[model samples]
Target: MLDWDDLRIFLAVARAESLSRAGRALKLDAATVGRRIARLEEEMSAKLFVKSPQGYALSEAGDRLLPHAEAAEQAFAGAQEELSGAAGQLTGQLRIGAPDGCANYLLPQVCARISDANPGLEVQIVALPRVFNLSKREADMAITVSRPTAGRLTVQKLTDYHLHLAAHREYLANSAPLTCKADLRGHRMIGYIPDMIFDKELDYFAETEAQVVGLASNSASVQTRMVQSGAGVGIVHDFAIPFAPGVVRVLADEVSLKRAFWLIRHADDRRSERLTRFAEALGQGLRDEVTRLERLAADTTLAGL
Candidate 1:
């Protein structure tokens, strides 16, 4: 019989696309991952990957086997969750994936409410730049700026908010008046590193024609910190810096950037009270934060937060 663990290794290698990377992700050594793959291939009489300088690419048979393997994996997991759920006391780990800065401020409050509601629930929160796959159950829940793509998931729009250029007090006083986008030429801009999709909604200064990016990072927290430290002016969402201690929103009335936040959860577990509780708690937090964020944007007094 082909081992289930062997199939799991094959799935991981295929998903990650590199033996070494899959090894690190699976917490297995390179030799072990290679050995498992070799053993599986020998048993099945096939080659699974074509290796090259660019890394491993799946062979034809490997490609065909992927969906089946993933489907089986999902079936097994759903069965487990459903069976455990039927027994009634809420149990099992619930993974929440969210971006750093917002998750740092928001998820804890929601989680505390969930944990209170279900004592047996174990919460694991991973702060990532985005959600990867809802179909595969990469995380049980996600807080994201994007709508969930999986049809089987329940998606709730949490809030609508906008982003504006923010600068240190020194930059506003010493720098050119940010009355219009054209005023941005030559001004150093702190921004998300190129390749961040979230930056697409925040191209506030790109049309200014004089745009200059002084520094970049993929993290919202990093961008907020740099802007607060006087490194450069950066585009930040109202929620992104609702409590920024030293920065001020620049040209809030002029920037045309706004977006909605969403909470995504798989529907297979939708009827579970804990899932519903967690989602409701999170939605309430987001609703409350949206009001606070708008008030922050309106409060021109000191960026005191």
Candidate 2:
């Protein structure tokens, strides 16, 4: 019989792609992790991993075994949750991966509320500029700007948010008057580095003719900060505007863009009651927060008018 303990070690190694890293995560020495993997391979009678300078690469056998292992892991987790009487309250660690904009402006408050309600729950947010790999278990769940077309993943539309051309009041005061998109051509634009835009949804400037990006970063927060510093005009999220006091919408009627945030999870995770509850809470929290922030931005805009 395949040992459940060995399979757990196998999963750690597969995800970390290094014995030492996996060992650290499992709180065991490298030799113990290696022995566990070797034993598991012997029991299965197949080579699960191949060593390369880049680290452990899953062999065909390992690829074939991965889903089964994950399913088993899920089953065990569900059983543990049921036995531990945690069905009424969320506990343990939950990690979420998201683009830095949401991470910086949105999740902090939302997660704080959730954590406060569920005292035993621990939340970790992994903020990055690129897409997360759900299959590799990079996070328990993820928030994304665009729905992924391929993957064994389930996507839930959390909420729709808006963006518009914006600049610091001082920057607008110093620059030439803008009545239309044509005037944007003369202004220094702040935006994502062109080629580094990971998703088409993120190509906020593609729909407009303003081509030159004078200041750019792959991060949304950085782009917003540049605009706050009066560096240049850039497309800024409506929900994020309230956070930057001096940044105000520009050409609001003309250059508005709409986008949606999607919650992504492994399809198999749907069976976990803990995750399902958390997903519901997270979705509602995000919608509420977005609406609240956007309203604040609107009030700020009206006050400026």
- What number of clashing residue pairs does each candidate have, in the order they appear? 2, 0
Task: Say which candidate scores most in lDDT.
Answer: 2
Query: What local lDDT does model 2 show for residue 286?
Result: 95
Q: What's the lDDT for candidate 2?
A: 0.89
- My TM-score estimates for the predictions, one after another, are 0.67, 0.93
Winning candidate number (TM-score): 2
Candidate 1, backbone clash total: 2
- C-alpha lDDT score of every prediction, in listed order: 0.72, 0.89
lDDT of 2 at 20: 99
